[model samples]
Target: MDIFELDSAFVLHTYARRKIAFERGENATLFDQNGDDYIDFASGIGVNSVGHGNGRLAAAIADQASKIIHSSNLYTIAIQARLAERVVRLSGLDARVFFANSGAEANEGAIKLARKYGQNSGRFEIITLRNSFHGRTIATLKATGQEKFHARFGPFPDGFVYAADTEDVLRKIGGRTAAAMVELVQGEGGVLPLDEEAVRNLAAELKKRDILLIADEVQTGVFRSGEFTASIGYSIEPDIFTLAKGLGGGVPIGAVVTTKKELFEYGDHASTFGGNFLSARAAYTVLEILEEIKNSGKLARTIGYFARKNGEISAKYPRLFLGEAGVGLMRALIAKDDLIQQAVLERAHKERVLVLRSGGSRVRMLPPLTISKEEIDLGFQRLDSACRAADF
Candidate 1:
């Protein structure tokens, strides 16, 4: 049986699998079994920040694995300690770190921390935005605002309330509210960025009530938005934030950073594979690469160039494209219609460019930060071809 046949026979039908299967990848491109190269604009949904097959990352992982891996949290691991220090320093927050294996787990940890912190105050409810996407776990699913993710997954855990406006948020924050979690840039909800002033105002209000502010930066963290974290650009300092997608470049890793260490007791949370040596090495290497990118000013230049090209594309294809949303490399091209968006994405894939969709109608592009200007131009050309092909 071929790859598709094998997948059909054994794999669970959870995801709508794409037609192509990638075999290998290297620096902003992936090769299929047929040896066709496709420019990766999705970047594994914003996980491959350091690009594919990075030699430095691979060497670091190999070196750490050779020495030791999978040391439990019961013992002190050198690499874990080092990585945590680096994270705390770069975050510009005096916080302790708890590692997990994915974004959902990180959010879960943050939720637990918030509830524990509010335990004495009789507060357990978490207020989230109406269109925000949190995670897939039972608790995180409850924390998510969209009803589509809640289908057939009931009964969900209690204490999750969706608020649309500031008044609604304030109304929901009576005695039971423990925290208010938000995604500064709602990646899955049509690449919508929250209004900075509104977020700050809400944060200040929540603070007066002693409500914790949890920023879900799962998709927007790790310099994906040309900053280490999107919260920094927004000028809102959340009490806690969850990170995962781009932290380990391609390796599975997640983290919850909080300003207060007293929020979580020792036995409150833990993860077996969270900060193992191999993953830690990969994450540390990613941070190092990001530092280099910052110092060389490549990240800033690339982001600026992409932003200009995005504007040009929007202007060039006025009929098909409505406009652009989002910040830095994490951007989206809003289509005039959902059908046009889907058609454009399909056509782009056929033209050897891989892009993504957000909220059904926005063409999401999260190319690796290390992507070259030439590669960005190529991607834009392919997208342009797609727009022309799918023109009504």
Candidate 2:
């Protein structure tokens, strides 16, 4: 059977899958069944930080799979404990962990942690910023602050307040607030970043009010934005942080890390597949590679290059591009209209380059963190051609 036919037969039509059927990938390139190569900028929607089929990642997954695919959370998994140690150490926070399988799950776990912190006081509300995105889980969907996602997902759990501005946030932070959650950069919200001053002030106010500060670092973690977490770049530490997406390279693992250890009591929450042996092993390998890159100063050097390159691109293509907003590799190239955006994406694909659209209007690029200078140039050349052809 044809690949598309096979997928259409069983899979739910939730995602608008592109026409290409990829068989394998190396670095930022994917190959179809017919051996056609395409430069990948989506990086599995920012999940594959290192890249597709990375040699180190493959060996780690294989090694762990051979030993044990999974073991329940009832017993200790040494790899999980070790990974937790590394994450907490890098996060520069006194924290414990609760792992899950996706960004949404991580956000859910964070919500629970905050709620439980104020359960006795009946303060269950979470303050979320306008245009912020958390995840697809029911609670997170309601917390997303986007009306489009809230459709048909009700009756949602209550106590989610979408603050319009810093003053609004302060006004909304009264007796019911258990936590104030935010994303320094809203990945799915057209790549719009929150005001740094606003975020800092809000965090400070939340601290003054004794409300937990939650950073949903699902899309901005694991060195995506030049830092391990975007919160670090913003210089504001959160009480509880939700992480996933790029955490385990390509492996499925999400986690909630709190500011202090013992944030959540035993039996308060749990997940069967969270922090499983295999996923933890994968996370450890990813961390090891990150540490190596950091120690070599490669991480800082690469981020510097990315920022300079982003500026150059914006200057070179002023008409085709609107502007750029990003710290490192987590960047976006704004197009004027959806029609132009669609044309560029299609033309880019024809030229064997893959890109993704954010919120139907903007083109988002999250190439592998391991993408070299040569690969970046090649992909940009192809994208430039497509963008030029798709003049608005």
Candidate 3:
């Protein structure tokens, strides 16, 4: 009879969730059915870049739905082509794109691209960063660097190896190495940023050895890091990059963008729902808003400034805020203990501030890029109060 009771009956509990149900959201705030407002920091796990019910996004989606929602990939979609052009133009990486339904699907396409490129080369292995998070699919789960995800999912798609640095990476790659996949920020790995030096060396080495370097930009793309993609912050150019999360501006879409030379000739890969007209319109809307945000520089600077501000917060309360790490809008505050994490999350929820847990002991914050400085201040104040009142 109750909403939570209905959810409990139908939903399998794969995630350790907070006990709250949001009825609707606007900008960076969510309201429960009872009319309590919560300052949103998770932003649906970084999917809502332009924030809830963005006028432009809603209009674009509505316009496209009125005209056409989807057509088979066999017929060229004009909007999809336009979105692809914009993606290539902004990336400046001279890449083509293939759309997919979600982040995991984009990654699946990337893995397939690597395997296809490895054909007849006696190399079929992909090297991933240790503690890296890719996706939840079988191929991606196998390719994921974290061993925990492999639990009960195996006998997975073979030929995935995890290594930490250039040395270990080199050791892992042999005659069977096809691609070296990495994330600039390990979003699920406690927001750990990859070593830039290691990435540079690894990219160069992988390039020299003719191995494709795939950057998983799912959680770190579309100005979340004060730029187009977090990969830009590292200055490491990947051969193939998978993008999702923020790309659609809160719509369901994914893209695998890659170099002109890296794409398949014909029959290489495809997705039926990939570049449909509606999602393409959504992507275009997102990019347009991002351009405005970039031009303003206020939101960009504020997104970048939070790291330093949180760094100060970390110093002020070292016992509670162990530290802060991440780039741009995608950030995580290191909690001193798991109990603090749970307590802060619970209290924040009760106080109407939404947060998330990552890698066991971090409070993940993914406020929309459109979030205002005032909103950030308010949210952080609530979070601070929640932390202080939490039974740690």
Top lDDT: which candidate number?
1
lDDT per residue as tens, model 3, 26-137: 8887788787888888899998999886888898899899999988899989999999999888777978999998989999988988988888787889999888888999
The regions of model 2 sitting more than 4 angstroms off are none
Q: Taking the tens digit of each residue's C-alpha lDDT, what string does model 2 give over 157-200?
A: 99899998655888888788899888888888777677888889
Clash-forming residue pairs, model 2: none
Model 1, poorest ten-residue lDDT window? 165-174
State the weakest 10-residue window (summed lDDT) of model 2: 306-315
Would you estimate the TM-scores of all the predictions? Answer: 0.98, 0.96, 0.96
Q: What is the lDDT of residue 340 in candidate 3?
A: 78
- Any residue pairs clashing in model 3, and if so which? none
How does model 2 score by TM-score?
0.96
Cα lDDT of model 1 by residue, 336-355, tens digit: 98988888889999899999
lDDT of 2 at 38: 82
Task: Please identify model 3 stretches exceeding 4 Å from their true place.
Answer: 260-262
